[model samples]
Target: MYIHFIAIGGSAMHNLALALHNKDYKITGSDDAVYEPSRTRLLQKGLLPKEMGWFPEKITANLDAVILGMHAREDNPELQKATELNIPVYSYPEFLYEQSKEKTRVVIGGSHGKTTITSMVLHVLKYHQKEVDYMVGAQLEGFDTMVHLTKENDFIVLEGDEYLSSPIDRRPKFHLYKPNIALLSGIAWDHINVFPTYENYVDQFRIFIDSIVKGGILVYNEEDLQLKKLVSETTNTIRKHPYQTPEFRVEDEKTLLQTPEGDMPVSVFGSHNLQNLAGAKWICQHMGIDEEDFYEAISSFKGASKRLERIAETSKAIVFKDFAHSPSKVMATTKAVKHQYPKKQIVACLELHTYSSLNAEFLREYQGALNAADTAVVYFSPEAIQNKKLAPVAEEQIFNAFDRKDLQVYTNPEDFQKLLEQQHYEDVVLLLMSSGTYGGLDFNKIAEWIK
Candidate 1:
């Protein structure tokens, strides 16, 4: 198959490009801008476009399909050309659906735990030597590509993102999956630029629940009140299974789960992760994996990349980096670290990097999110706001929004680094939360300084 990707530098798009290229399909792509590691990876695979800007000539009749990334606008030159030629165009999620339509799609969806849940399922499947096609949001250990597609794999595990599929495709990406087995981790309002109201953001999940294939099973987080209500009201033909945080105890900072067979020690911790474990367990059971097998396989599962990933650690202090820009994610991560290391002084620093987090209206949702930390710091770059075309936000506004009078806010990374360097690190757990790098601060350098 010959396929072209518009805005191919995207994380998912580049991964998909590499996956298809490895499959020996003729792959071509174009983007206005490309950054590392997508740029480096694509170049290594010989998939990177020779030049940066889009060229209408890249779109032709012989191409089997055009996969559009979210970065591309509706009027992107190649997109326009493809439309002009009536060539088949698929949003990244839409194309994924097209590729895995014949397989049993197991989609993991929610505001926060999607990546972790998807990673857990993939880890267990790989442990059991189960051959499957898959797409996970984060780069995981022992996995070469975030996306894997094969004709022979009968199952496909998809990390179902609720964001808009593409600039032109307004439907939430998860809606297109139509999974036979689906999991909703939880619902928290996000993507303020798209869905203007919290109710509107929640309605997407309801729509996603409605979109499941007939007789499909939905394994959801019963602890989330909103999700519980939504699942209860849904009279769809699918079967509903709810999971909460499983019985677990933290001993010496290591989390162990109480399973039917015995107590199984795991590499991941936190109530959120425990809930993720429960949901993944249910999904694995549906996939014909029994409780014993699931526990054995999951014992080796560490975690998804950047979802509470340990960056550097010393006997005196430990540093963790998490991709947690949303309010719910921030709270969950903070609470997890504190619960895991109650004796340590938790110093949590978060970057308000996402559009939702930086927006004036959406900032209020973050109230008390970082309150679990002994010391809370919030960082945002004015340049980022300008780049996102968002109105400038003041530090006071952030302080008020978080409802923390003592919240230290920073507009500079260097100053933030100095603050960390000056802190007493003994018996402390430093949690760095952000979807973006904390204004490109060298976290390793900061970690060394703290150590």
Candidate 2:
């Protein structure tokens, strides 16, 4: 197979490129600017472009397919050249569907917890030596690439995102998968730039549920009233199974899960994580993993990267970095951390990154999200806002939005750094939540301080 990628340096696109390259497909890709990890990985794979810009001359009639990434615009030069040559173009998700159409597609979708749920399922399956093709949003410990593809695997597990597939393709990426087995963790309105309204953002999940194949299986989080209501009311003729957070308790700072055999100690904790584990167990069962095997494997599951990941820990203090930017997610993470360490007074810091979190209108949704923490701080880069071409968010707007008078807000990285350096770390847990690094804060320095 001969494939060309436009905007190939994206996190997802680069992973897919490496997967296809490993499959012995002739792959070529172009990206104007590629960051670390993606740049290093692609270069190591010999798939990195020699020069960084789109070259229409690279597109040829011999190419079998052109995979378009979300980073590429409709007017991208290489995209135009491919279109002019009448080459078949496929959005990233569209191409994934084309490749896995013959296999039983298992898609995990929702606004929050999808990545962790997908990682948990993969971890259990791998523990049982069950090798199946998979694509997850975050990097798992055992997986080399975020995406894995094979011709022999009968099933393909995918982290189904509700985000747009490509600049030119307005549909949600998950809609293209048309899964035979699907899981919806929960829904929280996001991507305000595109969806514009909460109602419109929710309709995407409704459409996702409708996209499941006839007689397929649908697993949902029953505890999420919004998701439960949708699942109970859906007319789709698919088998349904609902799951909630299982019985668990924290003892001596260890998360223990109650099983038929006995109490099972797990590496990961938090109510939200426990809920994610429950959802993963249901999906694994559908994929032929028994409950006993699921619990056994899940006992060692650390967690997906940046999903409440412990960066540094000591007898006195611990630090967690989480990829939480949405209002619901922020609240869930803050509450979870507090629940796990009830005796300690924790300091929580959130970085308002992502387009949705920066939107002036969307700020109100985050009201009281960080209330669970003993000390809550919010930071956002004005430069980032300007780079996104968004309206400048005022300090007054931020205060009114969070409704927390004591909320310490910083508008630049220097102030955030000073805040981190000046903090005393004894007897307190630090929770840092953001989709992007807090303006390139040296995490190692924070780890040293916490230690």
Candidate 3:
């Protein structure tokens, strides 16, 4: 089969392009700009476009399909070419669904923990010598690519994101998967720009549950009241299995799981992660992995790329970088770190980077979200707001949104870094949270400075 990918430089898009290429299909892709990892990997595989930018000429009638990425605008020249040629065009999720329609699709969906839970399932499956076609959000340790497809695998695991499928497709990506086995980690209102109301944001998950194939199973975090209520209201003929944070304890900065085998030590910690572990376990159980085998394998699962990833550690303190920007996520991460190290002074720094986070109205949701931290710091670049064409967020709004009298807000990255560097590092844990880099702040240098 021959296929072409438009806006293929995206993390998921590039990985999908490589997956099809590995499957021996003729694949070509075009993107206006390609960054590291995607650029290097595409170059290595000879899939890198000879020239950057949309080339309408590259879209040919002979191609089997054109996969569109969310990065591409509706007026993208290559997309227009595909339409003009009357060639089939599929959004990334739509194509993923087509490829795995025959397999037992296992989709992990939620406002958070989708990547971590999906990675856990993949890790355990690999440990048990089970081969499965999979697409996870983050780059995992043992996996060569984020997307993998095979003809032999009977199961396909997908990290189901609720974001729009593509510029042309407004449906949530997870809604297209229609999983036979589904897992919803939890529901926390996000994407304020799209779904302005909390109820609207929540209705998406309800629709996702209804999308499960008939007689399919849904494994959800029962601890989440919103998720629990959604599951209760659903009338679909699907099996529902509820999970909570499994028995676990933290000691000397280490988290140990109370498994059937015995107390199993884990590299990852916090209530949120433990809760994710329970959801993963249920999903794995549905996939034919025994409880004993799952626990044995999961003991070695460190974490996903940036989900509470340890950037650096020293005798005095440890610095962690996490992809947490939403109010609920920021709260959970902050509380987790404080819970794990009760004695350490926790300095929680979050960057208001996304459209939702930068919106002044949405900032109210973050009230008391970072209360767990001994020191709370929030940063948002006015330049970023301008770049996104958003209304500027003021320092007073930030302070009131957090409802913390001592909250320190910064609009400048240099000032933020200077303030951080001047703080006493001894007996303190630094938690850096953001979906974007702190305006190009070097994490490694900050880690060293903290040490």
lDDT of each: 0.92, 0.93, 0.93
| lDDT at 197, model 1 | 94
Q: Rank the candidates by lDDT, best first.
A: 2, 3, 1
Rank ordering of all candidates by TM-score, starting from the highest: 2, 3, 1
Q: Model 2: per-residue lDDT, tens digit, 242-289? A: 999999999887889988999999988888889999999999999999
Candidate 2 off by > 4 Å: none
Return whichever of 1 and 2 wins on TM-score: 2
Q: Which tens-of-lDDT digit does each residue in 115-224 have in candidate 1?
A: 99999999999999998999999999999999999999999999999899998889999999999999999999999999999899999999999999999999999899
lDDT of 3: 0.93
Measured with C-alpha atoms, the lDDT of residue 177 in candidate 1 is: 95
